[model samples]
Structure formats: structure tokens, C-alpha cells
Target: MNARKTWTRTLGTATAAGALAWAVVAAGQPSAAPTSEPVAETGPGYAIEDYNYPGADRILAEQGIVLKRGDGHIVLADCLSEENLLRFLARGRADVCFKVTADEGFLTLEIPSVHGVRTDDSVNTHLAMTAEDDRVEYDIPAKTWEGVGESVDGREHVLVEIRVTK
Candidate 1:
């Protein structure tokens, strides 16, 4: 063959081989496009929030108590964790106490069959309890023990919520 024709054929073959190699590499790789349509939430308008307390569900299921929500200010206390913690007395269950972390605190919980709550003078506190027919709120005097639930009305009451302020 002529030198110019031979050079031209060689260059064309190299170009064709390069294109074939590139197509093989591209076909083997995964596509970058999204696979499915975006999901639309259907049920409740409110987005489900993960307001889960770390161990609260297990505690509730095992102990038959519901400690649902808190603002990180008031938390369940180990009665022996600190001195002067607020204490609660229940009719059938052992006493439970709460430790106040901030100057003001709030916690929503359900402890059934509660009878009394004792507070420390450090923070002013309030309690809300519910009976079969009615809900009662109490302004607990600071540093004093207060009667609630069956102690006050002779009816079984469930302590529902608590709030405290310095």
C-alpha cells in the first residue's frame, strides 16, 4: 500500500478502537439517574416526629407507666441521685422523684394512682391530675409536701403532667 493511505487507515483503526473501548466502559458503569418517583405522605397532615425518649418506651411497656415528653429541663430522677429532689408518692407503686436541671422546667407524663408530691424550696412547682370525670390542677407550694389524687378527693387519680419554675 501507499505510505499516505497506510497512515490514514492506521489512524482510522485507532480512532474506532478508542470509541469502542469508551462505549464498553460507559455501559458497564451504573447510571446516575434516580430510579423512582418521590414518595408523598398520605395519612396525617402532621409530619411524624421522632420525639422518642431513649429508653422511655421500654420503661412504659414494662412498668405500665408513660413518660412521654420533656423539654430537657425536668427529668426522671433516681431518688438517691441527689439531695432535695422532688418526690412523688403513689398508691401501689414505689415513690418516684424528679431532678430539676434548669431554672424552669416542664415534663408531661402519666403515672397512675399517684397520691402525693413533695417539693423542694428551690423551685415552684405545679401538678395536673385526671380522674374518670374531671382534671384537676394544683399549685404546689415550694419546699412543702402537698396531697393529691386519692389523698385529696378519695378518688383514684392519674398524675398527667408537671411544671416547675425557679
Candidate 2:
């Protein structure tokens, strides 16, 4: 009689545990409902790097400088804000300056009638300019002021780009 009772208890416990496991698995699974609509995107999809210059419109409006794009290393600076700044001299415009922060930097801009550039003490500079469809470039040494665009050829030129290396 004891052996029979033990067998019955064991069978009941086994059945109960199996049922509980089945219940848990069933609770985890979805109901047999068919979906008709496809899932749509929810959050912000992606961020792309456009490399456009920030505050370009405001800068152009305020300072008459057309800043297009850059690698974010060099930036416009106040001429009297600090020492060792890259200075630019242009016809019919105030002197412009830039501050270089990295080992290498590049900026594409349009400062019309740029005729001279004064480099800082840190890096060499290469400038590109255009005059009436003719493009010209100048390589300037550090800690020196050199005649550029219009000063070199007596024709009006627009400073287009600046590339610097330390």
C-alpha cells in the first residue's frame, strides 16, 4: 500500500511540474493572431555627416565672409582676441584672422580681394585664390607675412581655401 501511494504521489508531482512548464511556455508565446500591416520606423533614423559650416549664414551676413565648409580644426578668431593668430588682409574689408587648433587644418571660404596673409608662429599655410576664372595658390611660411592674391598680380582675387600644417 505504501509503495502504491508513493507511485501515485510521484506521478501527480511530475504531471503538475509538466503542466506548470507548459503554462510558462505558453504564456511566453504570442496568440495565433495574423498581422496585416508592416512595421514602420519609430525613432530618429540616422545621422549623416554633411560637413557644412555651422553659423555660415550668420557669419556671412555679419562679417561679409562666405564660410562654406571645413574639417573643424581651424576657426575664425578675433584679431585682438589672442596672440599668434593667422591674419588676412583684403581690399575694402577689415582684417580677418583665424585660430588653428590642430596639427593640420583646412577651411574653404570666400574672402574677396584678399591680397596678403600673415601666418602664425606654429604652422605653414597654403592658400588658394581665384581671379576671373584663373586660380592661384600660395605657400606661406610660419611667422611671416607674405603678399598673396591681388598683391602678387595686381588683379582682384578672392581667397577660396586655406590649408595649414604644423
lDDT against the true structure, each candidate: 0.85, 0.92
Candidate 2 accuracy as lDDT: 0.92
Instruction: Locate the minimum summed-lDDT window of 10 residues in model 2.
Output: 35-44
User: How many pairs collide in each candidate, listed in order?
Assistant: 0, 0
lDDT (Cα, tens digit) per residue for candidate 1, span 43-157: 4566565544557988788777788887777777788887788899998888888888888877889998899888966898889899997999998878988888889989999
- Model 1 clash tally? 0
lDDT of 2 by residue, 46-112 (tens): 7776767899999999999999989888899999999888999998888999999887999999999
Best by lDDT: 2
- Quote model 1's TM-score: 0.69
List the lowest-lDDT window of 10 residues for candidate 1.
37-46
